[model samples]
Target: MRILVRVLKLLVFIMLINHLIACSWYAVGINDLEREDTWVKANDLKGKGTVYAYTTALHWSITQFTPASMEVVPMNELERSFTIVVIVSAMVIFSSFISTITNAMTQLRNLNSERNAELVKLRCFFSDHKVSASLVARISSCIHQSNKLTGSRVHSEGVSILELLPVSLKCDLAEEVFAPTLCAHPFILTWSEYYSRESKRLFLAARSSSLGAKHELFNTGQVAESMYFLSSGAMVYVRGDTRPARVSPGQWLAEPAFWIKWKHVGHASSTGKNCELVSLHCETAIRILSQDASTISGARRYAKTFAAYFDKQFDQLSDVWADVEVLQAMVSEAFIKHEKELLRHSVASRVVKDTKMPGLLRRMTSRFSGVSMASRLSSEEGMSQDEQINLILHERVRKYGVDGQKRREILGTRSMGSDSSDEVLAPVVSPVFRNPERRQSIGRGRFARNGLNVVPGIASAFRIMTR
Candidate 1:
């Protein structure tokens, strides 16, 4: 489009120049003719009113000849010169115009041909099965042709990289370079190396079925063998007596018994209407983790730095698993040895202080002693006072409002003035020091005492030993 406009502009310029030259030539010729006519008229006027009888047949008489009475004679030579000059100038201008038009048309035709060839190549590539085989060759040929025509050697490898880079990254990188072609060359090499490494790693690419029916309580403790990555769905993580937490995409859920020596924690179920997940076997994941320590470390760093990026309830559990694995790799140890140091630092930082009773209370409540505590709280017999308090605290912290005053209210703490002004009195019962009786009917005893039936009675016996 721009080339066509420039051609039209050039033609207009040439015509203007030709018109000016023609006007100048005609003006000069007209001036010369006028001067000659004036000289002829003056000479004719001088010879007016004077005539001598020269012929025998004519009587002697005086003729009154004025300027107007003199007949004007045609100057054929001057007229011929003017005609020849105009014709020659016209021919030269016409030839130049024709040449200009022809050159512009040729350029347009060449551009159209190049565009058509590119379109044909693109269509062939899209339809052909040999695209992978021929792509490199086609790119190389195109680059060679372009460089030859432009008289500049372009880097073909760089062009190939730009073609392969994802559009978003390519656009961002393109703006950073002054000479895009040259800069793009090195970037292609870098990208190729990185891509080659990543292509070797295992990835999950599987379809998931719809979770239509409500599931009965699943004993995740018994089901072990696989690790699941939330590829395009959300899940709720229900652990012990605490409220379920949500887990979304990019989070990985591994059964503890399969990966580590710890007891199974909880089960995960779909949170979204239609959940699609990618399941990788436990052994496969462990093998990858063992092979690529750097990948594991990088994943951990990302999770820690962008913890808030995940809104799913299972995010913390996933992060803890990831962090422990990375730290284990970094320290080259089987067990985490820095727990005391971390606690000390937290106390020093005033994140947890002895003087602040609530902080101390929170520390006690959030502590996870072992699987025993978890099993005791989750069983049908219900939780002990300490277990219930721990579960409540876990729910509060998981919801990110553990420090709210409403928590203290739920724990039977009262306002200062209200406690003093209250006039309500309660009867204190004395403990009867009687000998313990052996229970015969275990079911009736359990129901009468704890309001629940005894089924193998594990929850009642699993009590926390206070220090």
Candidate 2:
């Protein structure tokens, strides 16, 4: 670029000099050839005789100089001087143009060489690292995308490869793998609405499975590389001897990694009958999330919604088998299991802790029917970390069997209530439990009113359990 600028400046200077010379010649009558013209004409004579003498003298003059008496000039000599000026101007323009082209060509050659060198370095890096085939495929995709944007390949006539390297790499490796089957995967489509165009592009780059094939999206105890979404057919997911959970079409399974980094807790196999899946590589997902803050927030919201759904589902499942007597037990077990699952994820603590106190308390009452220290003191909000810790410690002490009597005596109030039948505080059940519809109606009312409000019946039940 600098070279081009310098060439332009030289061209301008040459043109300026030519212009000045032409102007001076015009002003001084250097190329003028009339009988009245000065500079080259004879001055002592007049008319035709002087013109003939000037012309004859020019042909015979050995010194190439006019006589002192010359007052007129011939046309041929004036035309020759004008032609010489035109030739000089043309040569200046031609030379400047040629020089500019040569400099441009040289610079292009240098850029091409530099680009090749960078590509070679990338190749060496890939070879030295023994990169996986999948990664190589992604790199090739990035190169192809770069070429498309520039309308030419890196080695062919195109823009500088370096200039588009960032964009090409940013295009997402998943695009290459998923391009052919993007629309076929339901899982990608399901989350597609939550993402931006760039995020969608990342999804498009994901690896996709062939239609009507059975594949293991996750293997028990293995770190998951990608998350799979079923677009057609169903996936059978099994964890241990527990019943195999069938993941139907339009459902995806990658929640374990969403909240926390953990190995696959279960294995999923496509049912082999017209099943198609879209798989998003975890690395690509992470990259996309990092680039978009809104997406991160959206992801957290989704996770919370999922958690709530799971909790509610668990409660419903418990209700299927439990009577009033075992309801408390069932609820306790459910809470413990749910809490354990949530805490396994590093993100679980962050999410669970960030919920507003009133909302969190309400969710605890409705979902687990028990107050957990992790949920109650989770938010740091206005309190210091130490205060949170102290609050948790105090709660634990009050709940301890050995210290319960002493705590109640010191507080001069019944901390554990009047119940002795139950060792742990059971969820507060509505007074209308005897009537299913009324109980449900009251429960909904309480849910809407306050999450932490205690039910008189539940408190009475706790009193009975303690007794």
Candidate 3:
């Protein structure tokens, strides 16, 4: 549509330029109409109609643009000079027009220029090699058929462009682009309802690929490296000589390869001109699901859900048990499903987050870190002895009331938490002392600075031992 609009614009520009040139020629004819040597007199346009005069002028103007010779000859010096001017102007004007068209074409081709460049390189690579022509043709055809653009496009370019994005954005973009395809799957439709984030990361880790018509994705007995999701196009699963089952879009192939070591038991191939499949490698699958301990259990739950989904699709368990092998398979699948659910629950119950002290409780407990109230208050640092005594008095009178028994209980709580042998003592008198004389009146000598800063718990224990 853009190219078409540009072409239309160029055409309109051409018409406008020609109309002006013709008008200039008509103006020249009118300027010297009476002169015998003038174009109007020499062409005998005065005897002819206005249409004839204009047509003659337009013809002369067009002759300068194209390779054709001019039909009307220049009559005099002025006419010859004007002819020279028109010819010179035509060169400049035509060059500009040619450049505009060339640029527009180049811009149009730029869209597929990357694809074209790769094809050219591929052709050059095969130029000297004596490879089969059929193989070359098929390779080229597949390149054109697939949409593997090698990250040339990104902003809304689907999940294939995720390699350029950050880990977080990759997960987010994957969630947005592959969610519909994932949720469309019968197994995932229910599975994702519980583990949506894990499902998205699983899609992120998957590598998407394209296949041409009848292209064998994997042959029977081929070592399986990836579990495939048929995002688009039909696939044929051929096991031994049985009828090839047509696998539709939004289906899984080699699902067991995702969780365990496995090999292809069937051949899978594209059915039409194109196929797009996203394969989650066993390594990548485990990495995505078991990023944390929580997700490990979630992965088991996913396997359990997937198993149950397929298990319900079969006929009654009794009917399938008619064959001994079928009976064994059913029992094994049931056991696997039960074990997965049981482990998922068990693992979830066992994940214990680190237990740290609560902030409020820690702060409250820290207030009783020292032996006596004053020494305990000293553990906080940056306070004078008088300030410590004032703080205790204020807190006791304001919050605990004037009861000495409650104050003793607070002291006991502090004593229980304190290790006074290792703590510094900062003794404070209960009654505020204004002078040295007042402090000395307690009768206890200067060295006797117990003041409840001693080991209260040890003393109590010793008293108990004596009893």
Candidate 4:
């Protein structure tokens, strides 16, 4: 469009120059042709008279001509023709310029309208996704508190609100209620690492389904086209003859649909009015990932880790069990669900010991200690997965925080029990201070500093005892 406008302006400029030159030439022709000598010669033949008798005196000659007169007549006609041509050219160029300006204005108006339309579409998108004003404000608060571009850290010094709650309630707070809001946050999409944001947002952009009371999300045996995120209201997954588990908000449903199976095992339906769900179709998610360069770069790195984890869990759990719950349990322990059972047994063995006491006493003590360790593990296993993850995240975000190495070591070592041969050993130090002269000097210094003969006295007592 710009190029076309430029071309049209250039053409109009050329026509204006042509019009000016033609007018100048026409003016010069008129002035030269109207000079005294030219005009007198043009009228000289018109002044000639002929004598005649009284009867012929009244008769007039209608036709008369001279060479100069005939030439002037043709010149006048030629000048008029040149003037008309110039006027016509000027009019055409002027009209074209006006039309071009009109067209340009019309185009600009349309472009503005198009931009407004796009803005409206985006507003509608946010609305349809249930991104309300309060949700936006919550996201803003999270961003403000973190003051960081990445979700790697959280700034609040407080413990998680649901940290000590029961498994079901904690899951409700962390996974169902809290997580959906975080996933929907725009900053999480725009400011986090590319793959991190894409993986999250791809699911966030799923098509929304608004359901009234008792509407089903999917039926058992239905081909698994998408996995759903419940944004608002309540839903339940019902298996035959079983009381349905309440589908918590912010939780992913039918996750097996995305990977393990092509069909749903149980029927999911809304239990309340105005239930809102967003579903991520497998094909759409893959296509989005493929189109983005940043996501593609990290896809291989994270995908393999996730795939291995998923397959391990799938193999360990029964088909009738909920995959999401199993996944949550696996994440909390940093191990698969089956491994947790093994780890629990290992804990029991570590706590119970073979001692030199009476047989019945030893058995009683062993039994009690074993029960204690087992109970501890069971309590830990009961924590909600989201709560556990938040704890890890909180630890990671605090500056100058340890890597939870002590916790890991305690768990790892205790799980292996006393009989495990793979235990790591501390490095041995040489006994340079064991030399008599050095040992005496060190002991004397320690005694002097303390104003007590404690070190020297202890050394003397040890020697005497050994002797």
> Could you tell me the lDDT of residue 328 within candidate 4?
28
Q: Which portions of model 2 miss their true places by more than 4 Å? A: 1-195, 211-215, 272-274, 294-296, 300-467
Report backbone clashes per prediction: 3, 21, 0, 1
lDDT ranking of the models: 3, 2, 4, 1
- Per-residue lDDT over 267-342 for candidate 4, one digit per residue giving the tens place of the 0 to 100 score: 8887745476666675565455444322112222122222234333323211124444323222322212112222
State residue 395's C-alpha deviation in candidate 3, in Å. 55
State model 4's lDDT: 0.41
- Which sequence of candidate numbers ranks them by TM-score, best first? 3, 4, 2, 1
Candidate 3 clash pair list: none
| Local accuracy of candidate 2 as per-residue lDDT tens digits, 342-406 | 33331334444444433322233233223375466656578754355445544433344454464
lDDT of 1 by residue, 179-217 (tens): 222112222122222222221232321112233212211
* Model 4 poorest ten-residue lDDT run: 58-67
Candidate 3: where are CA atoms >4 Å away? 1-166, 292-296, 301-467
RMSD of 4: 31.9
When 2 and 3 are scored with lDDT, the better candidate is 3
**Candidates 3 and 4 compared by lDDT, better number:** 3
Lowest lDDT block of 10, candidate 3? 458-467
